[model samples]
Target: KTEKTYELQLLNSEIIIDGKLNDLGWVDVEELSDFMSINYGLKQIPSKKTKVKIACDNKNIYVGVKLFDDSKKITFKSGSYDDFIDTFDLNSDYFIIEIDSDHDHQTSYAFAVNSSNVKSDYLVYDDDLIDDNWNAEWISEVFVDSSGWSIEYEIPIDIFRYSKGGSLTWGLNLIRYIKRHNEYMAWVVLPEEKVGIVSQYGHLKNVNFQQKKTFNIKPYFAYDNEEYEDQYYPYLLDENNGDISGLDFSGGQDTYSLSQSNNKIGFDINYHPNSFSVLDLTYKPDFGQINQDASEVNNTAYETYYEEKRSFFIENSLFFTNSSHNNILFL
Candidate 1:
């Protein structure tokens, strides 16, 4: 298989994570342009133009993409949160980037973002199986203008599991989905059968990265109030006809009380033990922001299974999954 390679330039200055790509670091790096459509016949020229630039520094890898669409028919879904993992692919114009940090071909990380700046990520293994629940702490932004849209990504080195090195070669592929036209394009031409074939990904060379040991602590506090009501049947007696001789159970008494307000305090600690491993610790974790499962009705005898939505359990969940089988074994 032929592989295309690009030598990443070392960033000389800091790069702001804004969607605009006007930084000196990005201007100095070489860009990979003229994306090809997946269909071989359409490879001559793509309807939309895409240009990608890559740069790396000691702590992070930077990716800038400029997509030009003459029609400017952009589709974006509005939401309260920035990260919309479940519906970003179906409802908006987006891009997906597959990265094999170790270049093992057995496993890869997929990151996606839409024109609305909503993000979705996952870990792919065994060729096609995807763990959409996976979440990573990365910076991404999108900006749309009259001509088209542009996106910038700043991926931290700690988010990936790779051997500590100075210069390394990795596997990478870029894919764009135009929702309005239902068009798919890629940086590397791929057959329809090999659409998501990570093994066929091109090569990214001369990635000079320095893994830095870092620690982060996030503390949170929450309060809630709850009210409770109690109801019980009351014993009844007739005074005129000798009380206690007959019992009437026709009425019930109700009692209401307000319990003490609930107060919670917790923190999450992240420690980078090495370049290839990370340790996370949490207390009283809150998963309120996690997306709820889709409503389903099952009348069959077998029970239905739902994906894990909690951020604490979804991040780096492959370690807890049994790769030989499809079950996730949490010990």
Candidate 2:
């Protein structure tokens, strides 16, 4: 089958991202439908219907999606912000937007949002190699009605690094998941035997590109203060009265107060050195706010694996690793 293509148009007016597709700018835009199911390498009609539309402006690209289903049967869980309901549960409906900013078809960005309005984003390298720790800031609103549910996204143009040109064509793909039927549908049906998912994406044509200076800096500050008290023996202390030379503290003990404090300030700089590449710099890197990994107890003779969450190291890890499949060095 030939690859599908869609011509993106400019929005006539502003669109408020209220999760409703009632904007006048989207009136003349065409909708992409007739999604096909790719379950077990079989192409068939899904139980529900799905449609997507794309439009753009000078500063942002707008996406509107409608997922038709029974309002009551929609599965979702409510939790804290960025809880990512889709990844944690097996029975949840969600939408995924994959965009190849550079149109290289080798790497892409995957943005996902569930019915609960929670969002999660990640980077895809070599089609299927996913770096789930990657995060981006974007706006999305979700609305649920009796007929079905819909979502709207406003992605900033500055988030991606694309080639310089008057007009550009990017790769785009949309995916929808239905939990009730355990069905998966895609606008561009990816065959199971396909070598790469991103390579099979449809084209998003006529993207007006204007090269502007892209530079961003994020500053983070962290403070930690710890206070505690400990008991020690006077006889065990040396000349410093605080040093113990591997002595057993089983004799009379005296209490002493101890306290420690630390402060860290760091900045993450992102600058587009050219139209096709981005330069990232970190000064005194600080990633204390990132989530901690779950504690695991190992019984067998196997090495423990830990995911890299540092922004500086994982920003452009593909280039650092020379596109290695193992991804053991930089990911």
Candidate 3:
């Protein structure tokens, strides 16, 4: 089967990162308006109109989408931090952009942003397993008008590892989820048998990118105070002595103490030698933001596995993943 393809034009002028697509540079870029429903067949047109435009610069790829919905009601949940996968439906309207930078089909990156500008990103492997803990440094904004809503995205080239400095072909797909109508539309129609749509993504051609090795250093200091009462017994007198036979047992009084404080200083360094290799070094790692694993009842003989949500450990974890074993191993 032939796949849909689009040629990304290089931006001549600076386009504002705002959600409004009023810039002059976007006028020349071709708009891809032929979208199909992901739920229904490709022949049926969706109720709402959707158009997507793509452009690129030396440092980032810019994507602009205009979604025209006639419905007055729109669904959206407002939050900043990551939410549980089960709670995604409670959020408002959103869109997803799945990209396979390496065109390997074995792995792809999925970036999504809701109407509230909340981000949901993941790393998909083998069109099956999804690592929701994967996070990338990207910017996206949303604007709502009387007609419909629009979204603009700026994805840094540093977030991806691909062959640079020439005409490159990458797998690309866009999905728009209309929460009010419970509609799912995509640029490339996905079959029901397919689990992850990244494996069947269409092609994005003529993408020429200039790669630069970048380094980042993040330093942080934290001070914490803990307050708790500690009880102690300094001494214990012998109660089995014959001299105290007429009396009862004897014991020393308890002593109590107050709180304590601790302070720490650390730094994390991220260095990219090339597109394929990344080195992450940390002096003192902090996992305060990571949520505790949810409680689950275990009735099976095997152990239940929980996903890793820490940002430092999840980034670039695909490189260390073993597909045969379906596990991420540290070497």
lDDT values, one for every candidate: 0.76, 0.81, 0.78
Ranking by TM-score: 2, 3, 1
**Lowest summed-lDDT stretch of 10 residues in model 3?**
242-251
Sum up the clashes in candidate 2.
0
Kindly report which residue stretches of model 2 are placed more than 4 angstroms away from their true locations once superposed.
Answer: 79-89, 226-260, 291-306, 320-331
Q: Encode model 2's per-residue lDDT on 1-331: one tens digit a residue.
A: 8878888889998899999999998898889986888788898998899888899998888999999999999988665444454342454788988999889888888788888877877777787677665667799999999989999999888777688887899998898888778888888888777788788898889988677777888788999999999987665557676777665567668899989999999988988866677878888886684668668898989989876667766666565544564545322
Ranked by lDDT from best down, the candidates are 2, 3, 1
In terms of lDDT, the best-performing candidate is 2
How does each model score on TM-score? Answer: 0.78, 0.83, 0.81
* Tens-place lDDT digits, model 3, residues 1-331: 5789999899888889778888898999999988876555444678788999999998889999888875366666776545635435545788888888988876788888787677788887876577776888899988878878788999998888787567999999888888766788888887766666577889999988766688998777778998877655554336676343332325545658678898877777899877766888767666554567768999999999876665556776665564565664444
Cα RMSDs, all models:
4.6, 5.0, 4.3
Off by over 4 Å in 1: 40-44, 79-87, 192-196, 218-225, 229-268, 282-306, 325-331
| Model 1 per-residue lDDT tens digits across residues 90-159 | 5778888888888787678888888888777788776557776687888899877887889999987777
Q: Which pairs, if any, clash in model 2?
A: none
